[model samples]
Target: MTASPALRPSAFTDAELIGSGRRVAEIEAQALQSLARRVDGSFAAACRLILASHGRVVCTGMGKSGHVARKIAATLASTGTPAFYVHPGEAGHGDLGMITDKDVVLALSYSGESDEVLMLLPVFKRQGNAIVAVTGRAQSTLAREADVHLDVSVEVEACPLDLAPTSSTTASLAMGDALAVALLEARGFTADDFARSHPAGSLGRRLLLHITDVMHAGEDVPQVSEEATVSEALVEMSRKRLGMTAVVDAQGRLSGLFTDGDLRRMLDDTVLDLRNTRIGTLMTRNPKTIDARQLATEAARLMETHKISGLIVVDEERRPVGALNIHDLLRARVV
Candidate 1:
């Protein structure tokens, strides 16, 4: 019997993989740097065109460029620019009706001579629509015909064979991002506005959700009067299932908070009896609280900073009006 050497899955050396990755990254980074230096009056003109347009910005491209254009449109739309992607191939097949003179057309092509994209230029010009071209060839038909041209030329493709649209696509996407971000800043787009565009996302929950939206209010809030015994507090805590009770003064204002941990501590004193102990004696005085109108993110931060899992929501008069715990925040996706 002979022993065999252990077999590995890969046929290529680690050095080969690392070298290819580094080369691609270096080429892309250099391309971005070059584009940044070349951005001039034309880039500003493109931004102003979109800002001044009375209708949506129509982004169009073909093949891989189309994919990048779609993403760019989404980023622009989410960041406050009214934009959408229209396939150049479909534009001549009746989708052309989607474009109007009031809208601006942003056409993207690596070679700047995509027949499908160029076919729509005449129609756009006839309708008095503004055209912004993003292309690698500065002198191509698309560039010459556009009202504004954003040059995204790359000296070489990240693809080793130089046949695939690798670095070209990266440059185009990055340039699109630059444009969208510049417009976003100029429009004074805020986080709240971004959240509105992404209402189903976690960012929306953090930005739009208030404590009152997720907190248990009214009778659902576990509470005990200052005169209540520890046993009575335990009943309220158990009934509410929050593991804690807000202890209020005779005027119904928040005086303190008592939690299961407090009960445990009281039990540790052999002389104390839960049934006979007053909750006021063992409750934590002036516990941390949040306003009902405060953002849920603030509540999450308060709970995290105070090393507690729950919070009592109070009114302007310092009266306990609601209750929430880490679980509530987790359920709301605010934590």
Candidate 2:
């Protein structure tokens, strides 16, 4: 329990500073490894208890453990588990009414003797709710009273004085993440399912945004008939401002695509006439296209894979139903 040496600005060295950081990381990594090995049948029991519960998980803790509990609750909620954090202090002050008989209480206390957390256990027991406790002490009150106990003990703290809850807190959080991932897998949660809960996040834009959501549709899509000239296709491209024009046949099915890059390359032929030359003769046929129902992220992938900057959203019959470019994806924040 010796105190850490005081770090004065003048006494600091780059190697010593970096070494301290590395030591902390090393200690926390070792603690997490220990935690992984100890996740046994009790872990399964805890997951089962949570899964069987009809209501949300009520996570309660005190101080630092409370912060971890809040994060755990958020992770669980976003990963398809119904859960929320309830401060033990607040629960003692009437917040306990939020918990129902169908809910499961996940209590966190590193020492397994937090008075605030312990105080609520009797109430939960009387309410006929299951208790899942996370603690560092195996023989403590919180552990003894619980239906399931997850041991998150670490040999020493990263703090030189061995007093701060550094390694122990890291272990607790890692354990919480482990539980969340296990529950997520058990429920067969998918990325799309996660995106539903995080619609405002970047992942949501990538997964939940369909090509139709961001594509230019109806007359907004740049298009011209195959019988049209290269000059006429350029008019459609300019008027629609899509940097490309889909050259479709009389049936409104895509025949080819003409882009700004085609216009640049067409300049290589000095004798080519934009007024008389047919757009179909200069257009790129069998170009990369996407389905309107596909994820917008898939469109970005298609563009990046082909080193192209635009895509045409086509229907099953290869008809141009919509049009979009990298800029459109950028606007939608899908790129």
Candidate 3:
């Protein structure tokens, strides 16, 4: 007989479902709080072992622990500690050759008895490599065999049946972050160091992109001689579409800036004649400028602070070399 499409007998109510989620979060939070207190001398020893190693940290684990191991490896590498993940299940199938004697092994196993991980311990021992184990069972075989063991044991699981690895995995991840952060502090890692590794992200663009990289150079920069009439400056600004034009002297040195705002104020004077007035007469003198080598994000800040939408790139001698507007920064995703 076919079954009816009615609700299951034990389905949860809306309030009960939300309460279960809340319980899980509270349990995981408490687990992390406990894990923090357990980060003792062994944690320091783990950092020491990794810092002393000349080779990369080879992190390994099975199942869910493997996921956390991979993330930890990435964090360490991004924070100036060279590291990578080597899955234990694949290690037995010839991936073990990827690890060298100089490298340190950071293994994660909540039970501390993952057969795939434990199986590789003898090989690491034979190579004389240091092993850092993060496990819940302090007296488990893998923990006992490791050079240093970090305890991430939690008294309870967030799962209703207490069989899933909810709290245990959370504790393990927290321990991994603790290790990465400690190593980061010890190595004196900087944002530039981090940006070099994360060059594809928004943070990298903010740190690595400079004014020269985004500014329009050469003939592309809208500018006119200071002696040029306002009508001529308008032609240059219209041709470049930068909403502004620079006023430079005969030597090509920036004398002042004339933008759409200045044009508006000039037009407010009913007697003023655009055809007869020189751009220098209506220009904003010594307008805000930036060095080409300065960060693009700095330009965003300068424009925001001055309530302007554009800036002129200048050399050491105050010559207008290039120009940029909020549109350029927007196109580059710096804004």
* Residue 262 displacement (Å), model 3: 3.2
Provide the clashing-pair count of each candidate structure.
0, 0, 0
Task: Write model 3 residue lDDT over 146-235, tens digit each, in one string.
Answer: 999999999999997889889998998888888888988898887778889989979889988999899999999999998899899999
lDDT of each: 0.92, 0.92, 0.92
Worst 10 residues of 2 by lDDT: 1-10
The lDDT, on a scale of 0 to 1, for candidate 2 is 0.92
Candidate 3 whole-model C-alpha lDDT, 0 to 1: 0.92
Question: For candidate 3, which ten residues in a row score worst on lDDT?
Answer: 1-10
Point out where model 3 deviates above 4 Å: 1-13, 201-204, 249-255, 265-271
> What's the TM-score of every candidate structure?
0.90, 0.94, 0.88
Pairs of residues at least 3 apart in sequence or in different chains that clash in candidate 3? none
Please, what are the lDDT tens digits per residue for candidate 2 over residues 1-335? 65555542457689999999999999999988888899999999999999998998999899999999999999999999999999999898999999999999999999999999999988999999999999999999999999999999999999989998899999999889999999999999999899889888797787799998999999898988888888898888999998999988889898889999989886876667878988888889988999999999999999999999999889999999999999999999987
- How far is 268's C-alpha from truth in model 1 (Å)? 3.5
